[model samples]
Target chain A: MNTINQYYAGLDMGSVSIKAVIISNQKITGWALIPSGGNYKTAATTVMTQALAAAKIRREDLCGIGVTGLGAQSTPFDARPMSDISCQARGCHVFFPSARTLIDIGGQFTKTAKITDKGKIADFLMSEKCATGSGRFLQVISRILQVPIEEIGELSLTSQHPIKFSTNCAVFAESETISRIAEGAKPADILAGVHKAMASKVNMLLKRIKLAPDVVLTGGGGEDAGLAKAIGQIIGHPILVPPNPRLTAAFGAACLTMETTSG
Target chain B: MDTQSQVKTTAVKGTDTAREVRPMVKDIYKAAHEARENGKKVAYMMVASHYDEILRAMDIVPLPTENYAGLCAAKRDMDRFLLRAEADGYSQVLCSYARIGLGFDSLRKELGHIPEGSPDGGMPLPDMMIGSSAICDPRFKWYQATSRYLEAPTFSIDVVAPPPQADLNRVRDYYINYQKEQFQGLIEFCEKQTHTKMDKEKLWEAIRLGDKAWQLWYDIDRLRVAIPSPMPSQDHFSIMVAGHYYTGTQKAVDFYQKLYDEVKYKADNHIGVIKDEKYRILYGGGLPPWHTLWIFNYFESFGAVFAIENVYRGFDPVQVPSHVTDPVDFLAWRTWLRATAYHEKARQNSGNPTVEKLLGIIKDYAIDGVMFHACRSCRATTVGQTHIKTELGKYCDLPMMQLVSDMVDLRDYSEAQWKAQIGAFIDALEARTDQE
Candidate 1:
């Protein structure tokens, strides 16, 4: 067994953001999140530094590290590059041990993975060359609506009637959203429609993998209440979004480091 | 955080025989050019065209335009041709090989010569064209479209490969009769185009040599079932050029003979394609993406090797038995056999033939997972893969992944995206094995 005081770190260098988590004795001790900007190596270093400070530990105290997500391979860190899918599955299992399926809508890609009872990925489906089913879709809409991404979800919930989007393409939908605004449609309605549109694409991926429950949603998009609500409504099941939904992959990476060291 | 060493990259080593055979592909196009220069007739044909032997027998150079298109894409020189086709109102959704071939032909006609920077010195204009119904609907239409550009006449042959569960015993004779007529019609067409009568002795000799090459290829493929597979599909793709295009010639027979010897020696010594073979994958369907075949090596970095793939598998078991002395009769039997062998094998097992064959391959090859690369440009290979995936789940608990990209269109592929997916898939395979 690992000593309770021995610490480990997991970092998810995502396309849009970098998330870092520190763990000791199987519990998360500290975590940090920040925009990735253009330089992932710098973002990774900064986020890990912040996470270590939050944990009240120096870098020398860490026993192991696991890195995941898009920038994993390029990160200048002494870490084993882990699969984002496996990391996501492990992270979901930490909070919801019974999670059989995990849907992670990240900044640039969406993934649906079937999780084994032991929190390993059994199989998975991912969005290919498309932004319609990802948090990037939300980012695109946020820019067009002139609303901060954090506020799009709550504002969407306040809509009386959400507009129905005709196209699922992000570029085409951008022009469509502008047209709706010019036609006197409410911002909340357009935002709500975008959430529904994103949910539809997610639903298609879920169906292909033959979604099983209890389902868990994680990643940057899971932070959006509007999208979660839309997905739950469309899939006819409640979605369990863990605390700090964006940090699960990092948490999973941390858990993996502990397992590798102890085993 | 501390700095670590960069990711180590490993390149998949293709066999020396396969490597030697690859350069011969360029010579094929060159031979066509030389043949046309010397005033010998040439015929543009699809890969599935049933008349390569007839054309070779007639001394007409078989210019496999589809193979040339793939070569262009492999060389990363197909954009100009593809752009020309798109500008000429060809849909991007059509088979990219067709688009490249049509675009190349249109450009050549406009330039009154081969386009500058064309791969392999460019394919020569053909005196005639031959298409087949076996591959996909586009197979014939693609040739018919090119025929207009060359002012050449086109001939089409039909092949009816039925489902695995179909009653082959009852329909076999009728199918063979139809196929024999098709082969006869093709020979007559060649006779008229080349102004040469069909030589029975030459045709018979071609059939005998083709049968020998097919037998050798089948033997070579079976060698892959060895632990630490002696050959990877990358090598298989390269070496298949002979069996595919030059089946009737002694050159193809010689190539396969050398390949079989090399593979046998490696298999007997327990030599694998990679040093540490962890997971054996079954590339279930779809032609390989030409430009990024290095992705196979990408899988190798994870200690995973594609041990076998259904597509580009060895020619359907040789149907020409020793007693088969007639050339037309042999071709008819071989064509019919190629169309029905998988289905016939599946009928013996009582399940979906394609799925049953895949399951059989998993057991035979000791495959840990399956990958179906659903090429966007070719519907024939892409369609029915979803159904196969669903059915596969009913029998085995293996991990399966489907990747989407075009076989010839690099624009449809993203290296970053493929790496991420492949990384995740390898992790899943690891997890599955660890639990087992």
Candidate 2:
């Protein structure tokens, strides 16, 4: 537990993707995101190796490791399991020090947390056991619309009349999207509607907790410009999206290692 | 994946006295079964019906169905009944307690006896039923539905409290008078069903016993105001069985008296439910998830002890006076006062009654945060919890979170999700405390 130029690694073993980030001298040096698939331990190791390789550091060189997300418990890593809410708050705050509110849209769940000035979570609100407001819902729609996940944001932005989805349930929304397709609706319009539905769901969660200034969106869902735009429009405020938003929690996990090591 | 099978029951008792509750409840059911075998009349009653004393006066075995449902849920045996009720055309959205009761009755009729593995020897078929809609309409209606299956005469009483904004001085007499009339009707119904005259002396004795037990219970509950709470809310949920289900009986009185002494001794010694008490939480209103009572211990792992719960606040509102010699009048007055006590206190504070009461509890208990379990099946508990949480946020600087799940429905809950939320909440509470 050296407090010098010690390296720290954080792995976020999320439901949809395993994310890893390496930090040195209080800065993120390398990051990796890979599909979690079915084996969390393998995913954790693979992502960690890639992130370590990118950072040009050996595994033994790391001073500490922090793990987070749904699969953190089972991951084969000698790491401290931190709540994703805490990690997300710390990571978002490091990128934007003014950030007081953070909305992390992970694969399966969306969480909204209030951050203190010192990069600590003050409170958090999680989405119920539903996928309509999550990245999985977006992924489901991507497969149905035959659109690449990466292309969804740009494609959805071009739509003028978004198909109005009737339900906020992920399963029901899938059928609704199919019905819209059968009705000869454009894919971009349907994707836009999906964004609106997702944004509306996130807005409901945001409304439940106290909304503060400098709202930052992170996690896989943060990568979608269409969703960010829709959420921004709904909340009547622009949201900050840092570079590689999905790595924020992993980065925060890495940053927390600094504190753990220094202590 | 059957979430039902995934649920594991825990035996961690919050207090030694609380350990007596399940056995006491089981013995009540056993007594009811023996009562039926011995050709004695038994009455199915709701927990908050306020008529257990009358039934006790008449020597009618009072089987509290809601308490039984809670026990079933706690034992993780409720899904069989719940699923049966769902199969019998009852909506899953209906009150889970009702579903369990109706399902139990339906299954008993089908099998010619209690279901194979009913917890505490399943509730005996009642000869009579006394139902009240004081808390919610479904409570009485649940009994009425059960009557259709069991053929037991069901008497439903309406005991609506005046609105929180109502001027009690103007409405108190009317409500008490109405409630007294309802009790009279209930007594006549019971007397007719049992073929016995109303026993005035016995009723008085029952009332006196109930009052004594309640006072002792109140003293026991107030001991939680001590820092490093001697008893956690999980223990209260168990220990409340006597006051809730067996009130007016000597057993209930003796139980409370013993519990009061035990808790008082602990409070004096500054003994806590957990050794290192860090965060003191106010269980801000809702029926707890009975199946996952282990969640209480999980919170304990984070050095959090639920100091008090407002859900089953059994003490008589001291501010609301009751000075009636007549038993019926006293019950009516007590019922009305208990219902409006929070609102009456809130009017003086000029805020939402539940919110005001919670803020006071937070202060009195030195609470660090609040956890509101929003049970989906029970609207009476779940509806305004978020509003209270929001109001608490506006009024106090404390960490609060709403946990949404059903008290009895396994399908509506996820332990992983709940534990995650609890972890985050405790972390936030610690961080906030550290900063302060």
Candidate 3:
């Protein structure tokens, strides 16, 4: 008897990060991430190679490739691409089956999705197109604080009484963050405060989706402790942070294999 | 000189831009009288320039389709649009812009009357017309209903598109046919007024001038893709008027090249869409329509770049399925399918089949945000803005913002609301910037 492995791939070509996930039978087998640079093609191929390596599977052993992300349709292999919401929901459901609400805080956009009892998207919402709470926004702010992003998550945990910044515009926010530094505010506190603001921005969208219980926060932004705690506190619920929040979309992309590939 | 300074009406006299505009304004004033004198209600029929030809052929004084005057009455008018939708049992797929417009339009602004005589450059009501070119599906139906209510001749141009199976050559033929029909209707209307056979040379001149204007506009746009986003979106309206109205004349072409050269100069100085350290944003909003294209370009100097617009490229999908014998219908439909995006235009704005297809462009172009223009006059676009924004977030996880505007009513603008909304929106974007 001969059998073929059914593989699904999800590629999230976000403004800040390019993530890819390989899944089989709705299980996330492996994942990879790379910063989106001038040429996304290189970024995409790098992540794909890493994910394939992590999964210990050859690229040719796949039945179908399902891509989902901001740049899903642009996936190189002509693999079918689905919406980010659909892929995120599928990805989040793999871990916490009851996670009906998903709030993906990526680099450039904050997306809130309400999932069905069957792990499908029932409704969704997003913040305005500006970069305040997204990865793009964070990159600019991080430069002002001079803190490495990987360290932002750990540093935010040490803050006590974070300082709040006024003005929502990214340019102005950057200025405000600089002023806080000038005033000798603790870098950790300022970072926490900024994460609080992001949480507030996300809360607005969560309200649109009715803030159902058991929220799953994913995306590159989800890796920040300040954001995770702030979001959890704002919504008055315990938010679920996956092992690697940034990998959720890509992980979900891999798991999105139904023989038909139709919604 | 920058096109802004060159086209400033206050600066130049005897220039064709001023000349054409002066006469059109005077004629509108006269025609307003002509209609009232003929015992016909002189309605100020404002419409997107995309629908100007059809409206012109219908002998109506059209308003420049633009952002609303300032958002007061228009916002309240949403109730009327909602009522209309409720009565019609609209599907959930409809966006909020339409619901609001229909609700707003249905309201009795002042006791069953258009309040006789408020033509101080305000959007005048039409006696028997409602512009519905179905730029999206909902507006098509809304205008169709409005026409029925006014008992006006509401001619819907179904923008019959070519299939993906059709060859590119066939598509070019389709373009020729659609262009002919639109021009034919325009010519017939102009002929009835001027009593001339549209003088084929004049039609050819208009076409040539229009194409040149487009090229010049594209050249100018190339500069917009620079750093600090280049020019802000606020100036897009001025650009549109210069491009839209003046595009018909040689003055526009000259003005455009002059503007382009200036932009090229600034770009040479390193002051454009590609700043060394600014983030570029490709913004996707509904068609700038008339006076609001500048609003879309406002993000230029703020580390943003709008590389393309899905709405502006309705012609991107222009492919002819068969030979069109009636050049007049062809031209009208060509204009229809590309712009004013009502029924015949088949524009892929909100609440239309093309909305999903448009996502492909947004992705392909790597746009930073999707700005959906929720126009009050455009039932097709306005009703489902919320849904379109939400769906984009859901499907593509794309960030979207909406400017609740009118197709032409400039009075509906609200500097305060716009600023606040933009502030909030920008805040969200900033927070997402991967802050340390």
Best by TM-score: 2
Off by over 4 Å in 1: B1-11, B164-166, B318-325, B344-351
- lDDT per residue as tens, model 2, B168-227: 889989998999999999999988988999888899999889878888888887788987
Docking quality tier of candidate 1?
A: medium
- Model 2 complex DockQ against the native: 0.76
Better-scoring candidate (lDDT), 2 or 3: 2
Candidate 2 C-alpha error for residue B430, in Å: 1.5
> Model 3 misses residue B19 by how many Å?
31
Clashing residue pairs, backbone N/CA/C < 3 A, model 1: B164-B343
TM-score, every prediction:
0.95, 0.97, 0.46
lDDT (tens digit, per residue) of candidate 3 on A72-180: 5456776765556666777788888989899888876777877765666655565655778577777787888888887886888899988877877788888888888
lDDT of 3 at B116: 30
TM-score of chain B of 1: 0.94
Q: DockQ of each candidate's interface versus the true one?
A: 0.74, 0.76, 0.02
- The residue-by-residue lDDT of candidate 3 on B1-436, one tens digit each, is 1223221112111112222433433344455556655754433222433444333333344433222221212222233344454565654244444443333344324335432322233233445433344345544455564442344343444343443334435465565466556445544544454344544444445545655776777666656554433443333333444554443466667766766776666656655433442333434454443433344334443444555454432342233224643435445554534532232222333334445555665555445555666665555545665665666665565445676555534444443335334433443344344231
Compared with the true structure, what per-residue lDDT tens digits does model 1 show for residues B1-436? 0114212222355577887865789889888999988999988886655556777777888888888878877777778889999998899999999999999999998999988867778988888888888778888688888865788878988866666666788888888888889989888898999888999888878767877887899889888999897999888778889988886899999999999999999999999998999999999888888877878898988999988888875345754556766788888887777766667556666377788778888999999999999889898899888888988888888999999889889899877677778888998899899898
Q: List the candidate numbers ranked by TM-score, top first.
A: 2, 1, 3
Candidate 3 residue spans exceeding 4 A from truth: A1-5, A258-263, B1-436
